[model samples]
Structures are given as structure tokens and as C-alpha cells.
Target: MKKKLSPIIAVSLFLAVISLLFPPSSMAGEERIQQELRDPNPTLNPLQKALGKKGYDRAMASGKYRYVGNTKCRLCHREFFVGRKKDPHVYTYERLVAIGYETNKRCLGCHTTGFGVPTGYESFEKTPKLVGVQCEGCHGPGSEHVRLHRDDASPFGMGIPRPRPQKPKGGKKEIKGGFLAGADNPRIIKRMCLSCHTKRWGRSFKRTPHAFQAAYDLYKTPLPGDEGDQ
Candidate 1:
């Protein structure tokens, strides 16, 4: 003759047992980014300070930029904003978390937007909005561009200004700033995609109807909400 446990007591005991098997850090809902910042691994020195002020010191030192998140970009590029919401890249972090690699420093580099860049994803706690491959991930940080546009509305002025080339000292060709938007170029765009979609990642995309294509090309394809010739 033993006394039966109450419903509440039974549930509490079950939860306690589960907690012992899986610590709070292993909990699916936990924001592991914060914990990783707290416990910096010596071998992974760069990541230990990922969320620290000094981590982004170099980026900020330039005083030209910071990651303003996709939402900020949405104010201007509404169509692209809508399109990106449906893109698989938007859910990169979610996919990582689903596979329990959300805390893996190596995986986070590609999954997150502006991982090590200034004003990039610090902790989900601090910059949850910046999570996943975002507009800044490809277009580069928008702070400088945004600042320029907010001050003026000229086409030439709104973009990152092509720096004046230095004069040739010894008849050598001057080096120019690299192009910003390479999404339009088939060759350059493939490199951008391969940054994350390497053989190790097991992403084997063919040119079939359902196969992968650059986002710019995919944007041209007709979709449900799009108008004719879109």
C-alpha cells in the first residue's frame, strides 16, 4: 500500500528528471550566443570576444559603418524585403538551431548575418533581429549608405562613393575599389553562393526547375503575389 503522487507532483518530478538529462544550456529555447560570449575558449580567441565591445573595435574604428539589419533596408527596398522573407537564407539560423548547431562557433559564421563585423549579431539577446543571413550579409553594412541617403536623395550620392584613384607614381596602374553589388554577374554571384554552399555543406544544386539560382535571378521569376513580367 503506497500513496499515489498528485498530478502536479508527477509533472514536477518529470520535469526535474528531464532537466538533469539536459542542462539549461542544451534547452532549445535558450539563447546560447550569450553563454558562448561569457565562456570564451582560448583556442577560439576571435569568437570569445564576438559580443564584446573590443570585438567590433576595428570595424567601428573605420567610423563608416555598422549592420543596420534587414528591417532597416526594408524601408527602401520593399520588394526585396518581401522576397527575402521567403528565401531559405532568411531561416539559416532557425535551421542551425533545429540541428542543434546554433551554438557551434564554426557553423554560426555563415548562418548569422554579419557575425564578426562591427555592430553585427552580438547575442540573440542583444541583436535577435540581426540573426540569419540578412540584407547586410550580402549587400554589406548599410549604415553608411543609409546615412548618405537620409542626408540627400541623389542616385550618385546615395551609393558608396567610388574613392578617387591615387595617381601613378611609377607608371603602375591604379587599383580601384571592388564593385559592391556582384549579384548580377553569373561568375561573381556563384562565388558568393559558394561562400556557404561548399561540398562540406552537402549542397549540390543543379540548374533544374527546382534547382538553386542566385537570388537576383530568382527575383526575376514570377511568384504568386508578383505582377506580370516580374
Candidate 2:
């Protein structure tokens, strides 16, 4: 069998492969250039508007955010459940119950959100056992991230609950407190730490130092056959 080929076809294929191999914008021409880049936080994105410093505090004080209980989170995150029973955070919940805390009161504060708030519970019995620090508790609301998963697939880890594998956004960049050698978007990772770390009201992330870095440094989740990278 003989296959017909043209010189133009061969040259195009070679260029396509070369582009994929060296995806740096330096040689790809102005097609990849952006004179006025769109900010990561577009106006449409609610996280930027709601959590900003200007007036985010006022809305939080009035109980504007949703109260998705821990039970909702434990529906799928049974793995994290193993540690919660023993973690001190659960004990804090028990303490709150012993002291006679109000039932209608919002204990969700301790269970999720609020920066500087230690792992504790205002009530043990009142709050669901599976709810404390579930995936969404720390990783922002699941509404958008979940929906995005349908089309884009933003899994928590390598198709698993806990014990995440390495997902370095930046390839090799010096991020905030350390050098994240594999973080693709080091800056975004830094912003994520504070969804629970030191959150201020609706403020999601005030200062994401390593927003852009190598993918390796952000998360060190080991893929099944990636012993060499470690």
C-alpha cells in the first residue's frame, strides 16, 4: 500500500508537534500575547466581589451566607470522617454541648469559615459528625467548583478523597514561604490556604503571594507510578 503525501502537510505536522513540545509563548508569536490581560477575578466571579475588603464584613455579620451543614459534606467525604472522631475539633464540639449552648444558634462558624478560628465545635450533638472540615468546608463553596467538575473535572485529588497526589500548577517557581518547584499557578494555591486559615469575612484571599509558580510545589500528591519525581 502506498500513501500520498504533500510537502505542505508534512511541514504543518512538524510545526504542530514542535509547538506542543515547546509551548512557551516566546516563539509562538503575538497570538499568545495579551496587551491587557483579563484579571483572574473577573467582575462576574462573585468570590471577588463578595469577599473584597470594602464592605464584605457587613454582609457576613447579618448572616447572608448559606449554612450547608457538615452532614451535607460527609455524604461523600467518609475518608476524612475517620480522623474527625479522634481529632480535638470534635472534642470542642462536645464541650459546647456540655455547657448548654443554644440549639438555634449558628455553630457552623466553628465548623467552617472564619479565620484564626481553631478547630472546635460549639455543639457536638447539634452538629453532624461527618460535617467538620469536609472538602467544601476548607475549599470554598462546592456550588461553582462542583458544577465546574461536570464539564472540566476539578477532582479533589487524583480521583480520590484524601491522600492527594502531586498537582503542581507551576513547573518550578519560588512561591510564598518556600520554593514550590512544581506549582503551575502558585498564586492561586496561596489564596486557597486562607479560605479557612485566616479568612476575613467574605474575603476569600487578600494576598496570594505565590499565585504563579511551578505545579510541583503547590501539592505533592503522588501519582501511582511517579516514584521518580518524589
Candidate 3:
């Protein structure tokens, strides 16, 4: 005996079948949003912005425009400095020397820290500390930053953003500190790398990951295999 179902019941059954075939948003909901957020080369977050004019002004105003070498940075960032020693960049000069190209100007430009800056690497004898690619290589000359960090009047350090002071009804008012300018912005990092990773200079490096996400990961990861020049 065949009994016909009501129109409403038939419709409900059809919808249930369809729902099984294609689940509701809740079934694959928040994970999609999370996946989007987890994209490796994500655009800069809202907190980041280019330094532009402000950075230019500060660079010009900073009287301490000389390269202080990686040793100076080690005082504050010992862990990072240790990690850098494991990085290939730290041995750039050594690699050049090993290959008998130590004095080659073309190689020296990228092999040494602050190659063109004042008080920068001149010769192995003159600036032994600046022999390899160093912290100031990307951060620019760090002499001024180091001085300000030590100075009691305006002590600041690496990667600090500008702080806006609020007027409170307290005994002493607060003074705002400036941000790290382009440090957080990924684009600045890309440009800095590209400046040296040009076609002529970067043969093997071309195969390496250039994205900020990859670079960030590499910064933290310990070097693999042999420490010798390859």
C-alpha cells in the first residue's frame, strides 16, 4: 500500500537530504576564517605603517650616524646575536675569505656590515668587528640608537613604537616615545633584502625564501647541518 506524504513533509525531507549533501555553514564555520588568518604571506596588520617622513627626519637628526658593529648590539640582544652567528649572514665575509674573494669590492658590499656607511667596514684590519653581515646591516647605523638607549633622558631600544603620553593629574607628566618606524612593516624588510639580493649578487639566495613569514621563521630556527661555508 502506497501512501502519499503531505506537501510540507515532502519538502522537509528534500531539504534534509540537501542539507546532508551540503552541510550548513556551522559545520565548516570558524575554521575557514582561521585558515584565512593563518595565510603565510598575510598582508600587514592594522598596527603596521610605513615610517616615511618621520623616519627620514629622525635619521637626519640622529647625530650618532656611525656604524658601531654587531658587538654593540650583542650587549642588548645576546640571544639574537647568538642565533645570528648560526645564520649564513654572519659568515658572509668568512665565506668570501675562504674563496679567495675577501677583498673583492662587489662581494664586500654584501658580505660586510655597513660597507659604505661612515666608520663602517674598511678592511679586515680596520674594522674586524664589522667583517660580516650584522644587525645594523638591516637596521641601519645603530650608534645613535645605542646612545639614546643608554642616555637617561631618552632611553629606548630595538623595535619600540611611538608612545603617546596622556595628561594625568599626577605629579609628573609622561613623555611619549616614537615607534620603530618601518620595522614592523613587511615591505621595508623586503626592500632591504632586495637591495642586496639583486640578480648579480644573489644566485643561491634566489632559491631561498624571501617572504617575511619565511624569514621570521628562519630567524628563530637553528641552522641545519654543517656550520662550515658551503
The per-model lDDT (C-alpha) reads 0.54, 0.36, 0.53
lDDT by residue (tens digit), candidate 1, 4-28:
9999999999999998776553534
List model 3 lDDT by residue over 1-230, tens digit each: 99899899999999999887645433343454354346464322111112345653454455546778776766655446434545777788988778586875545666787665456688898889888777766555666555545543223332355433233244221111111212433455555565665443334353446543455445433342233312
TM-score against truth, every candidate: 0.53, 0.31, 0.53
Residue ranges of candidate 3 with Cα displaced over 4 Å: 1-62, 151-182, 203-213, 220-230
Ranking by lDDT: 1, 3, 2
TM-score of 1: 0.53
Q: State the lDDT at 181 in candidate 2.
A: 15
Model 2 residue 142 lDDT?
Answer: 37
Expressed as tens digits, the lDDT of each residue in 1-230 for candidate 2 is 79877889999999999887754433332232121123242222222233454433443443323334455445444334544554343443344355453232333443333222222223445435333443333333333223223333333422454432333357223221111111343344345433323322222122244432222242333221232243
Best by lDDT: 1
**Model 2, which residues run further than 4 Å from truth?**
1-78, 102-108, 111-134, 151-230
Cα lDDT, model 1, residue 230: 45
Q: TM-score for model 3?
A: 0.53
Instruction: Please tell me which predicted candidate would have the highest TM-score against the true structure.
Output: 3
* Model 2 lDDT, full chain set: 0.36
TM-score, candidate number 2: 0.31
